[model samples]
Target: MSAFPLALPDDAELSARLSARIGQHWHRLLAALRPLYGEGAWEGELAARLLGAAIARPADLRALDQVREAAPDWFQKPEMVGYCTYIDRFGGTLAGTRARLDELSQLGVRYFHPLPLLKPREGDSDGGFAVADFRQVDPKLGSIDDLRALASDLRARGISLCLDIVCNHTADTHDWALAAKAGDAKYRDFYHVVEAADQVAAYEAHLGQVFPQTAPGNFTFVPEMQGHVWTTFYPFQWDLNYANPVVFIEMMDVLLYLANQGAEVFRLDSAPFLWKRAGSDCRGLPETHQVVRAWRAALAIVAPAVALKAEAIVGLAEVLPFLGEPEQPECHLAYNNTAMTALWAALATGDTRPLSTCLTQALAKPAGAGWLTYVRCHDDIIWGALKGVIPDETLARISDFYAGAVPGSFADGQAFQAEPGAVRSTNGMAASLAGVRDGADNAAALARLRLLYGVTFALDGIPAIYMGDERALTNDPDYAVEPDHDDGRWLHRPRMDWTRNGGPTHAAIARFAQLRQGRACLHAGNPARPLLTADPALLAFERADRGGDRLICLGWFKGDAMTTDLSGLLGSGDWIDLLDGTDVNAQSVAMAPWGLRWLVKKNG
Candidate 1:
């Protein structure tokens, strides 16, 4: 039984030297940093020491100079819109991405998340999640100079570049893994390699299988190494052992190294699984929180401007803990997984009961922390884990409903990762989920699209649009033919079709986006969880100034002949409906099937 060392050795003299180095660079800012990190914290002191070491090294010093002048609260903004796309999918490479800055700016996008551009092991790189070399870019995605130039261009346009720092695991072909396989004792200490099957069995007993269809075990047998290597996601991607303090220091070096590369925000992929313990699920362990806390402490001390965004794709209960207290920080922003899943589920069921429940129970985000809300992303939709709160039978029905298996269902989606017992994840574009792909050119499809977009825009976090979703791009049937995109996610990850720009659907999208863009109520404003005045058929909420002005959004989840009267919520007045150019009385406001009315009180 090898107990992992959790702390570093004595370095008080080294701390003083590092503090002086930082003081020399940032004399004025040290006053603000001292209060946040405390007088003498290990993480704070270590970050300065690491910064000093980085400056002495033969790498570029320009990033360090920029760090000294970086803004403290650059992430906090009302109009911050995010755009996530693969460099190859959006452009072709790093330089190609530089060419599209003007287009991204047209969408009012201030933050860009280019998915995993780092070097990966050739055959199975888990879509670049399995990082081979943390220090360099994928040769396929141009050089470090291209990335530096792109970052400079993005910064000039007020767009922050967000990159993935895959903290969970590294590719099997990484130098450290290769060394460990060749009987290098020092390298073996870098990862969790077990000689005994009993230890491996203990971990597997409590651990949840990530990709149960493909990778079955928590630990994989690496024959070349003649040992069991911990592989949480896949056999080729070995998990790094954080029990060793050196691993912490080393990964921190990787983090700051990238931050210096002009990365304003780091999307910490699979962050919840950083630490593992026996007799536990080995996810979101106490040590995991501590490690993240240590990283937060380090960032506050050195890079006050750079923010840590967590990618924890867990249940609603486990999500809020990532956003720690303002004084002692964890992550600046977290993916709104519960709300995202709920939105899909709501659309399928044609009832906002689940959506309302999620909003009421699970939407209490911390003051300083923000939520990155989106309809879809590059990952598979994880369904069953939240089954404890939402029943398995309900989840199965929802899955079937979206897959077009259930009769009279509007959604035209394909199921991914379908297990033996009817458990599955759904994949489709926003338009497909709205039933527009089912050859409908009528008002029903348009109404459904509006219903989806209205809920998306009215949600409590930052709204994100999947690249061409604004123009009602349906699922691409040909993506399944390609080997790399065979995993049904490509059903939604289609190329931007500018040819359809002149169509009626495109005009509809433009109108919706115009409404979305004009709403000051939806942008960073706290909307009260809509108290359902009507039946489960209608969902309504109010984003109020709380006293002076109010913005009310009402939508009918289903039914062709349903009506909701909101005279109780809105006392009296003729309001302007942003969806249609009509002044309607609040006393008898009626909406069509799948119709949404965003009413804002008008002043004389």
Candidate 2:
């Protein structure tokens, strides 16, 4: 079954230039699918369906496409700042979220990521990730129309709305899953189903557990279907079989449908697990990139303003493929997961080697691509992304420290599924890990938290601040006891205390916002170069653009004050500290415990 050299028909609604853009990328899509599915009947049918979607794209969205076509690098510009939160937590509902635009405007948040607002399974929805319906918004959040209204209002204020699109799986109660259970031949092919124990055992040899504490393995037996279904994350979440062309067309339609509702960025969740093959790790596969690029092409044909953000929380080497080489662009933005996990590792060990290594890796991103960097996100912190940067034994120690297994470890984090032979993930808020919950680290937790956020702000990528981190919101210890919510990730996902926030952290954020305005050095095009420091506890980096504007960022990971030689990273110039107005002489600068420094070249 060869699926290459397929004809993707032109859409009548598309302008000649837009149709030509489709013509340019359609072959790349065919080239990707041919090796995976072959140039057979499936290719022609999928091409027709994709063209139909392009034609059916809303007129309003096509207008947006034209506007953004004029400003191609809008999202990549320096002023982009993101905030990720859940609607039920950030606001009571979509209407409430709309009412809070003043707050987002006050914080200068141009990119808003409302985490997983889509409808999910009735019970234990994996924090809304096990999507039951792609087009509907969660009733607890708001209606679909409310989401559209909120998105419109956000766009008017120069903010881009981001939503999560789960690509790998759907809830067991999803229409397709239900149809498959009812013996619908077409729907059954949408998911991976193994008939025999032997088949499951064969795949088990190569499969790794995503949630060992609860889900255990990759396959779950469904008696009604009379076969074992592939459930990568949970038994309720069935992994979609991407090898099937029908599944591809249906999901591509869902993407365009949501774009018409005003989503400017789609966070491609679980992107690494999209394409599965036997005798392999079944992650970050070549087919996976093809599907992403194809989706990118489809969006370009319909709504060019929207961007895809890959959530491949894997090792740096594995993540490189997701951000395709500059010429063949895949995701416009991807998560800086290595630096996120390495930040915790560095804090646990007070050694900047792994953190510095992660920074060095991120500094080498493709020209047109940028990362979504944050202190921590809604999920657990897995140690896999930091594998090569830190030794295995040391990583285990850091894990133990965050998991509360090590003595004097002040972080009140819970380890998820640390079975004797299983890889563990961790859960805890940044504030709790920084000792804010119990006032550990001599009551300097707030300062320590500020230091981390400062580093995140000073970095070259789009800095995203999670809901709780800005206010020093501590962990919710009650999550472990909550019914149907034993997942450790809820520890970090606490409800927003909107009234009590905007303290020192917010003040620090305001200062970073002030410095970022009109300063082209903060743009994503500038790579964050890791700066070597004489002190092992200080992590520093230099972010400078081609235009010669430079900013040097320094973070003290240690609990005690330290003075270090700044000559290595600092150039010959009168540098002004942007964070604080302290004047430092040529070669030496002293930092307070858990302090942060931002030094800019006196004048460009």
Candidate 3:
């Protein structure tokens, strides 16, 4: 894997080829880095050192590399479904997770993304996103050994393990941060340190507050270091100074270290905020993209089997850069947060205009990349990404309704911050926000949940089930009493009920999996076009394969019975509903309060 291995592998060609890759990728890596680290810096030396570490990559993982290279598009198939959750919430611990492999396999989930399990600060660790240690697992979740064991079990069962690697900042308690406080000049340079108040003001002028209610600003004063440090999210999370080549080298090594531990995919958290400069937005900067590209190059030479997933939740225009240009790709997969929120807006307003606009604009990806699409994930659903797509007045109405500010609004959601004039982001369980909750009509709630989830699966991408989402799990009222109770996102990040609430949600999930799997038309790589049926209550999309297999998914979210003419959307060819064995005709169709129709090829 490197030019100099302690002991070369028995296979001569493999060793020579790997050694050659180090030189092949080094120039690109240095070219990307020289802008930040400069020509005199040890960026090249650090890059060579990283290549040296690759020589130690486990043999088993090397074997996995070959399996992946042979079928690189394995993740783009229809059968590649993803499920995301916390290790503790999903299954008590790593050992407990292994015990449920059979259940996950039965659900047809091939990609399993466990939320941050890395060691974090003592309390209020931002749900483990604040990492205190790069290599250790949170003791509450399990030991590193347990994680490796779980990963091994998952791999054997044909599932790929996707883990989070928080790349933006480290907890103040991280070794590097602690060393800085202990008067180490080298380690002190690891963080962005400003000695004067005006130095902080310069960066703040262009940066917006990430946590306006809690953290409030971009810099925090650390008395121990006698300087103000840049902290984009929280004061306890110290941003790294990527201008220093050592910081880049260390983080890159940590990424490779985790990949060797059996993680097939690494979710690079806060990808846009990696690099910062004064008098700039300090987000999605060119330097950040260069850093990501350099890391991707390093990964190519080290662990080609693994993939990097971008976790940047910015506007559609800004997000596309993280995927890199077609010639030089950065991430292999990225979250379609734009679509995730658009789906919610469409469901809340019963209008597809907002959702359709988003799809029409930036749904396309690089040739080898795909989006990780989900109805809900472990975060507050913010509307900033769709600011222009949805009208401001419509945005207010939808936000208010979902925030439970409107009368008769069934969504029991909580605002992340109830500030007077700020854009209010909402957080709640997907089912609860979709009008599925207690005391309401159980039948309607079930139907709405099914409809929303059905659209999620029907879309052209890797459909991800937020662990408890499939069970139609609602907001957790009792989450307010937990140790880290202040964060409203905890309401939706509830522990899973293995019972699955009598399998109502489970049945629908399995049904969708069964219908979507083994269908090339449903693959993430297939062409998905928004069909303008001119129906306000319905959100329609048509997915088609090169082989002519087609699927038309329509989800009725108006919560009222509707009979609409769908004749304009269809040709003379006969189409059949896949949900129920019924023929779909050109005439007006009747839909229940919250129903979904999956019209497919007559014989499909």
Q: Taking the tens digit of each residue's C-alpha lDDT, what string does model 3 give over 77-124?
A: 888888999888888888888887776887788899999999999988
Report every candidate's CA lDDT. Answer: 0.71, 0.83, 0.82
lDDT of 1 by residue, 112-139 (tens): 8898998888875778889999988999
Question: Alpha-carbon error at 209 in model 1, in Å?
Answer: 0.7
How high is each candidate's TM-score?
0.86, 0.94, 0.95
Clashing pairs in 2: 2-38, 2-39, 2-40, 3-38, 3-39, 3-40, 4-39
Regarding TM-score, does 2 or 3 come out ahead?
3
lDDT sort, best first: 2, 3, 1
Worst 10-residue lDDT window for candidate 2 reads 1-10
TM-score of candidate 1 on Cα atoms, chains taken together? 0.86
Residue ranges of candidate 1 with Cα displaced over 4 Å:
1-49, 53-76, 385-389, 418-422, 438-443, 502-528, 546-549, 559-562
Clashing pairs in 3: none
Please report how far candidate 3 places residue 8 from its true position, in Å: 7.1
Pairs clashing within candidate 1 = none
lDDT of 3 at 426: 85
